[model samples]
Every structure is written in structure tokens, then in C-alpha cells.
Target: MDFLTLDYFIKLFNIILIDLVLAGDNAIVIALAARNLPKEHQKKAIIWGTVGAVIIRIAATLAVVWLLQLPFLLLIGGVLLVWIAYKLLVDEKEHNIEAKPQLWPAIRTIIIADAVMGFDNVIAVAGAAHGSFDLVIIGLIVSVPIMVWGSTLFIRLVEKFPVIITIGAGVLAYTAGSMLTGDPFVKGWFDENPVMKWAFIAIVVIGVILAGYLKKLSKNFISINEQGQLTIPDSIKNEAQIEANDSFEAKVDDQGRIVLVKVAKSEG
Candidate 1:
């Protein structure tokens, strides 16, 4: 099927799926980077941070796709993907650290951190799109805000409807399967038989499920408390409180890194 035909839509859908599927970390990073700012600056931080993220993502995707044209590069990408998958399963901690004061510095931190932490996403999206720039741009533009604003919503949905996570995992696995076929080592068989393609898809799907299940099992060993509000975490609660005392009726921790402790109005 030529990319100019109906397959274009399929490719576009796959690219968008890849973007949405991989956007959780981007949202978290943006939220965390801006979380430390005074409530007044949160919106600005998010806007600037998102702009930086979008720019960086486009550049990264373009660069990766360009490099993908090289001989044996797909094999290297495939190896990198294994590491990416392992990291996805094993690395649960957020990568972007909280920034201190100052707007540009925080924004810079967000961009840099996103560049590093988001490399995997870039490669994954590029591979899924299979060299379609239109699909890449469309996917990124459409999904960025959804990732930015709907992160909490996504989390809530995933929790309330556990199947959402399962479906997402399945998608990741399917992408991974497609990626494996494009690798230099396996590229030969990819065009040889339709059965091979289906088999690759099955393997990726099952691998992702098994890996996700193991990760879930690991989380079961840890205990997490339920919080009432979507406030920040405790580690930075005092800082936010101190900052909150100075002005604005309510502060937004744009970075979303801190765990907030709700203070009584009378206490302040």
C-alpha cells in the first residue's frame, strides 16, 4: 500500500497513537518543572515549557528520521528500543528535577530535561510514523495539549478504567513489533511473508503485557497513600506554603512535582 492512499490514514493513526501513548512523561516533566514557581508564573511556565517541548520534539523527530535512512541504523534503533522498553518497565522515577526560582532558568531546565528524557519518545514516534512528516507534525500538534492538560485526566481514567492501561500497553507492544520488523536483522523476512509480520506483532503485544504485568507486580509491594486533592507532594509543601503566604489567594505549582499539604485558612 502506497503512503499516498488509504494507508496514509493508517500511518497517521499509528503515529498519533504513538504520540499519545508516549506523552505521559512529557506532561509530568512539564508539570514538575513549573511546580516550583509561584502560582502567578505557573501558566507562563507551562506555555513556554510546552513551546520549548514542541520545538525540541520536532527537531528530534526530524533528526531521527534523517538518520534512519542510513544503512544498519534501524538495527541500532532496535537495540535502543530494547533499552527503552527496559527503562519503561524498570525506571519508575521521574527524570526532570524541580527548578528553583527564576522563570527562564526553570524554563530552560524543562527544555533540557525534556530533551534528555524524551528521546525515547522521539524515536518511538518517528518509527511508528515510518518517515511521514505530515503524520509526525499532526500527531505532535494534536496530542501536545491533551498531554499537557489531560495528564491528570488520563491518570484518573487509567485508574478508574483499568482497561485503558491495558489498551495502551497493547498499542505500545504493537509499535514495538512494527519496529522489530524494520530492524536490519529482521528486515529481510518482513517482506517475505505476511505471517511473519503478524507473528512480530503478537510477540510485541505479549512482551509488552508481560513486562507491564511485572511492573505492576513490583508496584504492589509498595504502599501509596490516597490524597484528597490534586495538590502537590509533601517534600515541597513547605516551600509552596511559604510562597503562598506572600501573595495570590491560591498558588499553582506548575511543575507539579511537589506534594501539597492543605493548610487551614485560619492557620495561615
Candidate 2:
């Protein structure tokens, strides 16, 4: 259990890596929240907002560490993480523009958004830190600047290559599944059935991917009928190469807003 060992360093590296990858949304939040302020106040807002986020993360990670010590809490957290991943994949409204032209409001929005959206990051980082508060703090310290300064670049990359978002979500799912299997409540069962760990991870990863795929499928065009029911637009069905008799499944986003209307795959 030497803190200076290579294994410990690897864990620390993992914490940093997770922070960098999964923190893109927070960066976007900071940027958008502060973008509406006066030009002179923009930089100040970003700096102070990042500082605020880091402080919040520290408190959140500390709380998660304590909560994780209890039985079954990790399992609950894992479920929440999985849901977060699913939402990340399906929800398309990540970009929120602000035109308030005010300073304090922008800064306030930044902090509030960070607080609301930070659970996924805090839990993922806490899991990667492996219960080391020092590791968590150091990891956040090292990665927050990259997110704050490099946010525009990261956002461009994510937009150009949407796979990055999927990858980030997958990472969250993997962390969540790992936490579930490693939770004290189920740790003994997993120890006795060693294969269960890999099985759990596989299920989580595949489930996430499949859910995302289905969400994508829902992007097909549909018409809202007089009764408020969804129906495939005849022209769109022909364009989509879908058969007339094909069924569709509507997918709702995290906020219960329907995003897409997709034709159900026919059973052979």
C-alpha cells in the first residue's frame, strides 16, 4: 500500500485521464455561461467559474468517498452513472446559449450549471481515485486548467467527431459498472464468481451502445397526427427505405422530451 508505488501512479493517471475526458461538458457549461458577459469580464468569469467548479468537485468527491464506504451506495451511484451516460448519448441539447449581457448572472449560471452537471464527473473521478482524496484533489487540479483553457478546442473536436461524446459516455459506463461490481455489498459474490466482473462490464458497455443506437434510429422523420400520436411521414418512410408496415418506437430524452421517432426493426 505504498503511496509512491507504480500502481498508485497508474491510478492517479487514470483519475486525470477520466477527468479530462468526461469534463468536456463542464467546460462547455463554463464557456457558454460566461460568454454573455462583458468582454473584459469574460476571462474573469471563466477563471472564477473554474475555481468554483474545482471547489465544488472537491466537496463532492469528499462526500462520495464517505458515502461509498457504506454498503450498496456504490450500486446506487453506478445506476445513476449509467443513466448519465445514456442521457449524454441521447440528449442533443448540450449547447445552451446565453445573451443576458450581464456579468453576475453569467457567473451565477456557470456555477449553477457546474453544480447540477458535476455529479457524473465527481463520481467518476472518485472511483478512479480509488478512495484517495489526495489523488482526487491533485487530479482535478491538474485537469481543470486544460478544460478551462482548451474548452473551445475540445468542443470543436467533439462536434467534428461525435464519437468523442460516445467514448466519454462509455468511459462513464465502464466506471459505473466497475464500481457496482466492486461495491462491498456485491464484492464477495464477484470474488466467488470471478467471471461476473467482466460480464457486468460487458453488459454495461453493450447496453449503453445499443441504447445509443436506438436513440439514433429514432431520428427518422415522423408526423404528429391530429390525435397527437406519432406517424411516419409517407415521404420520409420511402426516403428512409422503411416498409409501410414497419412499426416505430419513440425515444424520449432525459427530460421526458421526445427527440426522435424511429421505425422498429422487423422480426425475421
Candidate 3:
């Protein structure tokens, strides 16, 4: 395995950008949630929360790396990642999670929020990593501090230079293309037709950018009750075919982009 190739560096760089853009949001949420705690507890909450979140991220990325090895899953994951990249540009949902009053509560909030809000982050990183556990580990390790302490600096940087996001999304699109190339069913065909292979990747990268610009950003903001219980619109529930006891997986990032996906009945 020659690791000095330009392709390797591109993937590594993609992982770095993905981590930089996606990691900071989690950090901001932790800081805001921990701010309500006492000084000593705040310190502990930040420390433990960072550790717990990083650990879970590591596990999740590893799981994705393994899953991508399955036949045709790489192709599916790549398509999903393309949508995720597009959503990274336009999907902004807010999670009105309450900051806890106590130390454990605050820490728990940070961890839970990280886990919930981290769905895209995890999948994006895994896609960029391209089954390289080294890249995955490096990405997570490099991102931990950013997610824990560098939220404001990154937030400011992104605000000042919004193009940075486009660059990151492009990198994600490249990885998505790579996934399709690596798909077991298509690998041989692409290997025989290198020109067509590059063409497909270039198309995926260009298509994501065009779609991202042409589509409007969707707004899905749901408010929580005093107890942090969310009230879904009856219309939404009906459209989604949600049952009275349906469960959801909810996450909120620093930018306050909240996502709520209904879980399967068995999983619920």
C-alpha cells in the first residue's frame, strides 16, 4: 500500500476539511450547554463530554468503514453522502435542547447532543476517509479540540469566508464519486474504462454543486415544551405516516441545525 500518492493526500485533506467544518458546531453546543453549570462542574463536563463524544465518533466511523466493504453499499453510501453534502449547505434545523442545571445533566446533554447532531459529521468523515482507518482516526483526533474549544474561531472564519464551505462540499462530492468507483459491481467496469470513471466522478462533483445552488434551503424548526418534548405538526405526522407512539432520532448541531428522523417501529 503506497501511501505517498497524491490521491492519498487529497483524501486526507478532504477528511481535514470535513472535520474542520463539521466539528466546530458540536463544540459550540457543548460550551453553551456547559455554561449553565458551576465552574468546577463545567470543567468536568467539558472534559468528560469531549472524551465521550470523541469515543463514540471513533466507534461510529469505524462501523461505517466496515459497512462500506459490503457489496453495493459503497454506492449507496456515496449517494447518501452526496445528499448530505448538499444538506450541509442548505438544511438548517434547530434543536431546542435545554441546558441542564447539574454536572451530570450538562455532561449528558453534551454527549447526547454530540451523538445526535453528529450523524452527518460521522457519515461525512467516513465517506472522506474511504475505508482508511488511519484517516478516520486522524480526522477524529484532529477534530476533538476544534469541537471542544475552537467553535468561535471557526464560526467566525466560516462567516468571513463562506466559500470555505463550498470547498468542503466539493471534497465530499469527490469522496462520493470515489465510493461509486470503488463499488464492487462497478470497479471492474471502471477499471477497464478509466475515462468513463473520471467522467462519472466529475459529473457527481459538478452535479452536487449545481443542485446545492439551485435548491432552496429547507427550514424545519420545531419547538420543545418546558420538558424538552417536541410537538410535531399534525400535517407532518400524517404525511410521514407517523404512529401515535412513533419514535425519532433527533440531533442538533452548533449552527442549531436540528434533524429528526423517525425510527423503525422495531427500533423504536
Distance from true position, residue 48, model 3, in Å? 0.8
Q: What is the TM-score of each candidate against the true structure?
A: 0.71, 0.74, 0.77
Better of 1 and 2 by lDDT: 2
Candidate lDDT (C-alpha), each = 0.70, 0.77, 0.80
Candidate 2 lDDT by residue in tens digits, 63-85? 89778878888888888878877
Model 2 accuracy (lDDT, Cα): 0.77
Q: List the residue pairs that clash in candidate 2.
A: none
At residue 246, what lDDT does model 3 achieve? 76
Per-residue lDDT tens digits for candidate 1, residues 1-268, read 3555787877777666556655665777777787888989877988997899789999889888777767677667755665565455445454538765778888888888877877877887777777667777877887777878887787677558866556655665566667667766667778798797898678767776787678656644424458633333343445455453533234457786544345555654
Q: Identify the leading candidate in terms of TM-score.
A: 3
Model 2 per-residue lDDT at 35 = 67
Sliding window of 10 residues with minimal summed lDDT for model 3:
214-223
CA deviation > 4 Å runs, candidate 1: 1-6, 86-91, 184-186, 218-268
lDDT of 3 at 60: 92
Which candidate has the top score in lDDT? Answer: 3
**Arranged by lDDT, best first:** 3, 2, 1
Among all windows of 10 consecutive residues in model 1, the one with the lowest summed lDDT is 228-237
Task: Choose 1 or 2, whichever is better by TM-score.
Answer: 2
